[model samples]
Target: MSRREFTQAIDFRHGRVDMTHGGGGRAMAHLIEALFVKHFDNALLREQNDGAAFALPPGTGRMVMATDSHVVSPLFFPGGDIGCLSVHGTVNDVAMAGGQPLYLAAAFIIEEGFPLADLERIVVSMARAAREAGVPIVTGDTKVVEQGKGDGVFITTTGIGVAAPGIELSGDRARPGDAILLSGSLGDHGVAIMSARENLALDSDLVSDTAALHRLTAAMLECAPGLRCLRDPTRGGLASVLNEFADQSECGMHLREEAIPVKPQVAAACEILGLDPLYVANEGKLVAICPPEDAERLLACMRAHPQGRDAAIIGEVTADPNHFVQMSTRFGGVRMVDWLTGEQLPRIC
Candidate 1:
């Protein structure tokens, strides 16, 4: 067939991906040009090069890179799909280092027989997410697997960013007397995924809080340049992040259970499932640790941002020979907030 005829022959609405789509031949090229390239059309991507190239600001300082893989069970979930989740997860990973995300690369592993219409929807969602985050998807690869051997789709995304000069953030930066600030409520993403999976009847509507947090991170950086540590509680949730800080910084964490925000719907869902909100995942929330003196200022700055409107100071760091994460109960008692032993919710991005 002629080039024009080949391009026009694709039945995007009714077609299904087959082995030829991954054969690196005409079929692959057609699929890419029609779908992936059509949606993620940045100048660098337009070049059709094996890799993306772009110059950084002259003095932008250290370059940061983060990679994430998304294999959520249901391709489409409440408020988000795997596409946006892949983009948002990688972007937030880069941002957690106090950096500005610049570019992204994506890879897709698709199963044979997957619907072209569904694939297009996912590509569009990814494109929208990258565009909204102001981070272009400059390069990508697509591969197809046998139908029964793979899930419908899996995505892996890599993000590159530049951290400003003199900005240092890591789990080990939590110092004694440092305040632990949580950006917004916890367990939204995890609960949303679980509710969608189990078809739970929640009192209030719930949606996954999947979002790119680089802008919120930027706002926090502007106000708290000396921020010690930042972490987006994802797979293992807020409790894991606190435990990580304690272990890395060799200090204890003291959290007030009442101060950590949990939405009504999410709380109720967790109660029904016998899950602790602390151990649930969150895609859009962040855990920040900064000097005690800068706690209020940082909280105010975070609250000013759309993504962090419910930011709160949930805890503080303490000097302890044995690192431990403890929580002050609402009933005037304290207990150790130990790490989660088993998976509460699986395959939640």
Candidate 2:
């Protein structure tokens, strides 16, 4: 049904979602057309088909696909909300494989009493994020749940991308002597969420580092085509990503304590909360492994980008049969950067 056929518009100012909105009737069609279709308007989505269809450009190499679900508490947080976070999370996943994200599909689960105004805000944010990333939300689904059974809202985003020929990246590609690079400071996203959740008043303003990194990955691949691996540290933080790389490649990572970057505010927060920045989550930061010879070029390329102004060569890969991740403390002693044993923060992503 066309939106023009509806006699009245959705009450964005003072209306709540109910079971009828998701009942697959005229109410559902009107809700979708008035809100989602209006915000995420595009040729593909306008078709109103069960699925999206399009042709890929000739010479486009292997197709890459990734999906992520956002169940963050509070729904809204500093720097970003679940809407944009959902888009960035999946885009980065595809980017980590050295691919250019082409399109996205989103699925929303909203509670019965969710405010329409809040839902519109999230949908608009998602549309803006997709536009900035040069990707489109070509298709989606929406469902309503009982008020108490569902959280305010949950979003799951899936992305499809294309990797150019001869560009390959994987966790198992790291080799001994490769240089390890980090995009920026850690724990900003996690700390920001914690502060907002606990209502902690900190001296400095902190925000989540949620951003799409496909552009950064493209630049890095152009500058250093020999990159061995790329991975974003999310729920388990930098520590978990390094441990995964080590185990996958059967190598050890030796990191310098002083080389790792951490904002002072985040560091202070971690200390006060009995958390380690290394174990805290980050949304916009990424870890890249490249040959020692290509390290300087890759760092230069990354540092030139706005998203990677704080890029640094924090460590190097080593041959270790045990596949461990170790760090040299600024105190002149070595310590094991083991895998995170327990959940430091839950619903972090």
Candidate 3:
């Protein structure tokens, strides 16, 4: 069937997705045209092909790809939903590689009986995020599962990017005497999720710090092209990311508790929940490891960016056969920041 066969438009306000929408029939086409394509309209997507194809400009440099799936509970949270989170997650992954994101591919797994209004809202949010980040969603797929078998919706986004020329970044590139820097406060996203899930009201307004960081990484590369490594402390938070750096580079890390920046409200919330802020998740933050000589300059540059305004030099790399991440406490004691033993938060993107 063609446009003419779609006699009536989808009742987005009152309609719920059913099996026929995923049956590769008229209903599927109608849904795609009325929902996904309508919001994600772009030159590449207009072709309506199985996959999007486009030409890369000259001197595009090395290509990088990263994919992530979002299944955070309570799809709609205080500051963000799974839609924008999906875009930011994969885009940040590509940025950590010193790459400039170009395009994105999204795939949705929606359950039967899910509200069309909510699905449309998600798609619209995703489109807005892609537009703001200067990346386009050029292709995608959709699948429907039985109501009880699936969550409300799951989003998987794949991002494609091009690395900056003459700059190579990797997890194992950190060396002894390098400096570690954090973008902003820790545990905002995780805390926001918990607050919404448990319906707790706090004195201060807390929201998820979910935003794109490609521009911030680009600025860091411009300021200190010799930066060794960059990593986003997402699910496992700052401690986990530092440990990963130590294990990969076979080095130790010495951190100052006072230098780490944690919002007072977040700190209080963590204390109340019997959780350590270091192990909490962050959506819009990054950890950068650079040579000791360039640390100050890079820190200055990062502090000037919106995404990194609260940036701080939290630690320094050291030579230790044991590869431990130790932190100096405000009370004049030292402790080991080891790998998280088990899952602190589940279904947290």
Candidate 4:
């Protein structure tokens, strides 16, 4: 029989893995076809090569690339884990530049004794995320370390995206007077993970906002095709990203406390943990800066989308040589939303 026919009939459902399963042999080929290919079965993947080859949508646009390493503590959480989070994280990084996420490559670093079932579950989650986002896991790599040398699992992801023509979006493009728009509530992702790990009691459905935002970003483009700047408030949260913009654009940002939305439970949890919600990370939200003329239309468009149901115009860019991010408190006071002094929380993303 031909090679294709031989692979087609491999038993996937009843397969018990061994070292040979990853040893580049018949077992490896069978494993790849039976598991990975079955889930990520797009035309490009059907070619069965080391890499996928495909064309971008018809447009003379710039290609965007982003990579991220996710070592979030617990592999599984309320809404997602490292698997789907890796996909959403990289996708948002590219989408923040007004790009549409097109493809992804994943690499897994697994400890020697990690459960095979857990690895399969993570792989399946990654596949599901890629398919749902209309992106493909075109290529991937896997490695195993000795029993005591590694964590349970770590995933690194790289994404390729396409940006529209004539669009110049960046941290340096946040001009004074530009309106700052937030896609939704803050700190959900970080809080959800923390609660899950600490086993803190909280209401159900308090899920991580881990999601792919390119589609919502596409909607933003539809309203304000000339979007000036965009960013995903991760790592150092909304505070750090805004400060980066302030430094890049040589501007200041004045945020209205009331305008920034945070779920009550997230706020309560932050208070209990002595953490600031503004400094906590979020996986699915985006902060966009655009001309005032486009703010109304952009926020309206954002609110109409499922990912952006809590969209709000949070702040405005200003001319401040110090490049500070200041805030007007809800209690009628002014203060500085300074750069993240030291790591307030680690392993946050």
- What are the models' TM-scores? 0.97, 0.98, 0.97, 0.92
List, residue by residue over 105-149, the lDDT tens digit for candidate 1: 999999999999999999999999999999999999999999997
Better of 2 and 3 by TM-score: 2
Per-candidate local distance difference test = 0.91, 0.93, 0.92, 0.84
Best by lDDT: 2
- Tens digits of lDDT, candidate 4, 7-66: 246443443345565567776676577666776667776677888788789984999999
Give the Å shift of residue 33 in candidate 4: 3.0
**What value of lDDT does candidate 2 attain over all alpha carbons?**
0.93
Q: What is the per-residue lDDT of model 3 for residues 247-335, given as tens digits with 9 covering 90 to 100?
A: 99999999999999999888998988888999999999999999999999999999999999999999999998999999999889999
- List candidate 1 stretches off by more than 4 Å: 1-7, 198-204
lDDT at residue 238 of model 3 (Cα atoms): 94
- Global lDDT of model 1: 0.91
* Ranking, TM-score, top scorer first: 2, 3, 1, 4
284 Cα displacement, candidate 1 (Å): 0.6
lDDT of 2 at 63: 94
Candidate 2 wrongly placed segments (more than 4 Å): 1-4, 199-203
For each candidate, C-alpha RMSD in Å? 1.8, 1.2, 1.5, 2.7
The best-first sequence of candidates by lDDT reads 2, 3, 1, 4
